[model samples]
Target: MVHITRGLATALLGFAEEAEPESFSTGLGTTPAREFEVDLGCPPETPIFTHFYHPDAGGSVSAVFGMDFSTPAGRTHGRFVSHPQGRLAVAITDDLHATMLVAVPPWGIDELAAFDRRGARQPLEIVEAEPPLETL
Candidate 1:
């Protein structure tokens, strides 16, 4: 199972809160010590969203979030999603389609909700007292 430290969770939520009124996307990764790291390459004022089209595309895309993972800031990497309504940010791994670790505004890290790749709610297991490699 993928484990997230409480400190990482709090920092992510805090970033989302601070970016309020605008949805944001950033990179997520882990350090050599197994602690999580949030990428800081994207400046706060960067345009948070964009539009593109492909020949294979068939449907419209809305509320799309994207991040650049080309930076060499961390070891194992992923991306961060922050929606406007304090929506859950879904983390995707090679082994799973998506996993959600979410905290609504005014809620603490203890109140995060976990969801499986299939969108089914799952139990959230947090590693206590573990500090993240970096903070927002």
Candidate 2:
């Protein structure tokens, strides 16, 4: 499992929202020209294949991101792996479910910034330019 820090999540969000959309080819076809959302209702330690549609990366990629269900919130910390290699910004929806915003290709965890993590908000560092795109 990949370690997804709050800082990483914030950076990805900024890149996804700020960067211009660019299309990339996949094995199946061209990916969507918009950001994609995924709901991972996975239990801890269990491995599964999940699909992510990335606008910049231009295709649907599959990866594994799960947690252990021992505690009430499942795993407070978890990781997500993608084909072109990306980072996941996860919001714990419940004990067994989470909402993920995948920052796919052309994006990576470059740095961390200080922000307020109050209520439902997470802290994210800002980057001036969008990161490089990854290959298939």
Candidate 3:
């Protein structure tokens, strides 16, 4: 099971709100204890933004970010694998029609792989949990 920290959720929501009408991507990180951390990979004042769109999904815009896990800096944490490229992704439709938050690897990779190889199956469990206030 994978859990999303409230702080991380809040940050994602804020990013979705701020990047509305456009798509964005960035790197994500975690502490030694596995707490989620948003790795902008750049100074906060100047963020490196990338655009992505899904015409098949009703023109939904997405924010995809995180270290490639294959890079030296991404390997510093040693919590994830290099293959499949673990990263955080969020998508929201124009006009606030729909929104989604996607966590790669330990979060959703298994299910996706299964679907790709075998056909279809239940997805991994993702729980929304409140972290200690201090961690906020």
RMSD of each: 12.2, 15.9, 14.9
- lDDT (CA) per prediction: 0.45, 0.29, 0.28
The global Cα lDDT (0 to 1) of model 2 is 0.29
- Estimate, for each residue in 1-136, the C-alpha lDDT of model 3 and write its tens digit: 1222344434543444454444433333333223314432333332111112212232223223332323334322111111124334221221211112332333333312111112222232222433322322
Checking candidate 2 for backbone clashes, the offending pairs are: 2-79, 31-58, 44-67, 44-68, 106-132, 106-133
Models 1 onward score TM values of 0.48, 0.20, 0.31
Residue 114 displacement in candidate 2 (angstroms) = 24
Candidate 3: Cα lDDT at 120: 26
Candidate 1 per-residue lDDT, tens place, 1-136, comes to 3345566666776766776765444444433222223432333332211111111132233224333224443332433445456455443432232444445565466545665556566665454544342445
Cα lDDT for residue 94, candidate 2: 13
Question: What does candidate 2's lDDT look like per residue over 90-123, in tens digits?
Answer: 2232111222223455445542212122213243
TM-score of 3: 0.31
The clash tally of candidate 1 reads 0
